[model samples]
Target: MESAFTKYTPTEPQIPPMCITLTKFLTTRIQETYNVCKRENPTNIKNCLTNPFEARHNYGLDNERNELIVYRHDIIGTFNSFEGKEFSMSPYTISRYEVIEKLGQGTFGQVFKCYDHINNRFCALKILKNKKAYLRQGLLECATLSMLNTYFDSNNDRIVKMYDHFMYCDHLCISFELLNQNLYQYAKERRHIGLELNDIQKKLIQLLEAVECCSKAGIIHCDVKPENILMTENGELKLIDLGSSCFENYTLYSYIQSRHYRAPEVVFNNRYNNAIDMWSVGCIIAELFLGVPLFPADSEFDLIVRFVEMLGMPSDEIIKNGKIADRYFKLVKRTNKYRLKESFEFEWENNIKLPPHKNYLYYSSLHDVIMKNPMKLSLNTKENNFIIRECLLDLLQRILVYDPKERLTPNQALNHPFFTFKNINDITPKDFYEWTPPEREFPFKVYGHSVSADPEDMLSDAFENKIIINKKLTNSEYYNVFFTLLQAGHVANITIDNPFEYGSITPKQFIRVFNHQFSKPSIPKVSTDVPRSFVAQIYSVTDSFNSVPIKKEENPLTIKHCNQSKIIIHRMTDNK
Candidate 1:
């Protein structure tokens, strides 16, 4: 067997200053590389560090522990693959740690179970893949853990604690207190189709608590599948993998949440919230009961169809607002209804073109699917089973609400009778925490003279109040005014026009480049809803512009569609 570490003389190498501050005691060149590695996305962070390079600070003598605290990172020819660690004379030379076996691989790193010589304990060592970007993501995971660690202390076993962090084979490594097989493995071994009610309840309660702690710090475990959950020797569970998480309201990337457990808001492309986590909670619970994914689809279109079939078609407003709706649904102008595009062609032998895409559509009920599918697990007595099944389904519906606004928060799920818990407030974190993220640079610049994205809109259920302003104003200024009306009037979401560059032009932008003045501004008491594309074409003016009367002309203007609801603009008249 290879011994842990080979002797090395104490020395410090010249290194540049780094941005991150994980440790203050160490000063070495490798430390700087660790900092740069953190700025990248975890998946590709290994590509950032190119140089095999100078020695990094891998070990520090701990006076209190009376042992060497090691962080190993070796790259280039010095360190081969993880397989080579078995041959190295000094393999993973921590104070008293012995390498046992490889645990598993993560999104961007590998994990190993090591026996600690000093503490005589087994801990999980996560060796990150070499790359500056991946290093940064790992650092983020550490930061997230750091925040959670404050809530849990040395005695508390509520969650997995990061024992220490170091560099191993040019990869950032985080040490976690050792945990047993995750719930997935346990379920697979014991309960193939579904887990018992009691087990599900116990597991959910602890998992929910972990989620609560994360939300307390405004964290979102974007990936919340069973593989990320580890079980303790006891029945208690621990939520692992902080690497893929982000803050609650904001997202680091659009692609988040595992697809099978993905919430509708995330699927349809709407602004999301912490409720996305609860949605996963529902899927997991149902999967435990049914032994398969509740909503399984190979593609986004199929997923939408599943939802539509189960819950009925969503509102027109929802269909339009969804970023990906047009890809799956066809709008019927005459009927004023949206229909699902042909997901699959049936009656193929007949070559039925007459039926059309809309003709072959039918929606199945949610309750019906659950009962008919292979997922219906038989419980105890029919009476007892019926009651339990009803409660579980109810909980699932609330968590799986299509509108994120209506979806149950983690706290709410705690109170659901499905968990046999009553007071939702019982799970509220004692210490609430949040952080202001750095300013977000514009996501992706739209390259065009006229950006076709949604502009600010002023929509309301009642179009009775119409306050018109000048036809000529900057799009930015119009957007400013759009929000001003909402703040001033107190309104919710609304819709507006979307015609070409402005599509017929939505939230139409009026430019004043013609240099002709208007006949004073007028506020019209508009009726119900504004037509989708309400275009204003300037026709023949009074002969010679004498009778028409022109006010002082302003600068040329460009119209931008207000992405919101219906809004009408007119210059105010000087009349009573």
Candidate 2:
């Protein structure tokens, strides 16, 4: 074999220009050979082989410029790998808003008073962080805020307005109308300067109006402390912080009002409605008169004690319906033994001198004036304790009724004698503004909705129908209707079978039922029963014999044994 191979020398194949791949493969083989020798133990297969691509670069014969050009693609690709994965700009990011200053920060987000550069408008931008805990809180706040914004925008004037909301990256942003000072700051400044009685009365009336608007919307601002109220640039009052507020239909399992302002019903953990806000209003009104919170207690127990001291011990009826009544009231140590006077004593460290008679006597006298409805005095009264006190007491007492149901509604309060002053019909919008505090500002620049409509009319027209459309028909309607019908002994049993089901009754019929039922003096007592058989339609039978069919046989009359007299009534119609 050696003699034959000696005469034959093989020629090498023609090589094309060396490409990157070929160069890498050749370099890898050379590195592998060196590694195998360095390892010494050739049996190590892993050490014998090396990754060509990962090996250090080799110096090329070509100049630096050429070399740079050759590896340009590789370098660029490595740098650009993260372009789409780690970061990218979204369509909404085309325009950037200017950040003026940070308004406030909470666990979930930070609010910034920003100027929308694109729109040339000021907005409060809420930037929420994307975290599990923060996301949930953000979602809740967003829902509440969105609803509030919609409500205020629909009737914009003095309420906080939401502009827009969006998500950027992991952050959710909500923008609202930028506001100046909250009610807390306003009160602080006023307390330092001292508020006049006229100023106090004006603010109180504005607050009551705002509360009345909320009530009309069927929303209860569960949190109505000074902190939640806001002032605009112009002199007007606006209620804010609807995050803790709830719809009339919402049933909160846990109580959540501020300690000092919390109503007694809330303290006892009893079921409560919008009247909770009235209690807060009463507290605020009392604070305005005394220049401090009326029931500023340290603990829940102390709060209850303070309330009892001022309002007198709650009747057993109230206690039974309260939140912690069983715990605090039932405990003999905390019970009636501690009289109202003792509770009042515990509130203050020392005997504080009361304000001058001229300053506070008016408020004290006015307490029960409205509820009692005493005759109005002529404008030329002597201004004695009896006359002045009657006016003030009447106004305050109506606003501060213990029973929420008995409390004068905002509309009712507006119609009271307090607003029945001289030039009552001549008061202009400008005059109203003049009456408002300079430091206070309306949240809304433009009032979008009509305030002239009757409060009851604000309720959905569907409420008039037996099958209320878009509204929940409470048992209150049925109770009222039943009682009125009961007075007649024999009355129509109106069946409201799914009022929401359209075409069942005309809108006119619905309104008739609603007005008729709602006007009743008392709710009726009626028994209801479920039928055993499936019947899609309901029918009334005054007499069973009238509906019975008679059968006869030919030749001799055959009297069939009558099964136990049972009647089945059916109303067959296309409507069914």
What TM-score fits each model?
0.54, 0.48
Q: Give lDDT: candidate 2, residue 355.
A: 27
lDDT for each residue of candidate 2 in 368-475, tens digit (9 for 90 to 100)? 322233322333332342434445555555555556665566656555554645423333434333332222122211121212222233222212212112222222
The alpha-carbon deviation from the true structure for residue 574 of candidate 1, after best TM-score superposition, in angstroms, is 74
Highest lDDT, which number? 1
Model 1 clash count equals 42
Query: How many clashing pairs per prediction, in order?
Result: 42, 20
| Alpha-carbon runs more than 4 Å astray in model 1 | 1-97, 152-158, 192-194, 344-365, 371-383, 421-576
Candidate 2: residue 327 Cα off by (Å)? 1.6
